[model samples]
Target: MEEAADGDWVVRPITGAATGKTYRCPGCDQEIRPGTPHVVAWPAYVRDSDLDPWDVDSAADRRRHWHTACWRSRDRRR
Candidate 1:
């Protein structure tokens, strides 16, 4: 897992070979096709956070897939 520069998220790279389903990128609102390399990111779970960071269901529900470039430039987009 990689931390976002802003410390707001935890990101994980997904290999092309591992991506079997399509996903819509929240950044660009475009389709991430199957077999495409991408990233999966979820909110950073701080200790004793109000969102119940330890809850696996909460974290899984918040996970989003993003294109590598879109994720890299996320802060710059409107």
Candidate 2:
């Protein structure tokens, strides 16, 4: 797992061999075909500030799959 440059997210690489299903990339609105390498990212949770016990679950629910290139250049895109 890798921390995003902005420190707001945790990103993990998905190997082509491990990808079993297609996913829609939020960055480009394109499909991430099965067997295509990609990244899965989720929002970083801050346990100290939040009181909600479901924050962890919420973060998991927000996880997204992104094309590696799209994820890399996400901040630069408008």
Write down the lDDT that model 1 would get. Answer: 0.82
Alpha carbon lDDT of each predicted model: 0.82, 0.82
Q: Which parts of model 1 have CA positions greater than 4 angstroms off?
A: 1-7, 46-57
Badly placed stretches (over 4 Å) of model 2 are 1-7, 46-56
Error of 2 at 66 (Å): 0.2
lDDT string, candidate 2, 1-78, tens digits: 456655588788999999999999999999999999999997777444443555453555668999999999998986
Best by TM-score: 2
Residue lDDT tens for model 1, 14-45: 99999889999999999999999999998776
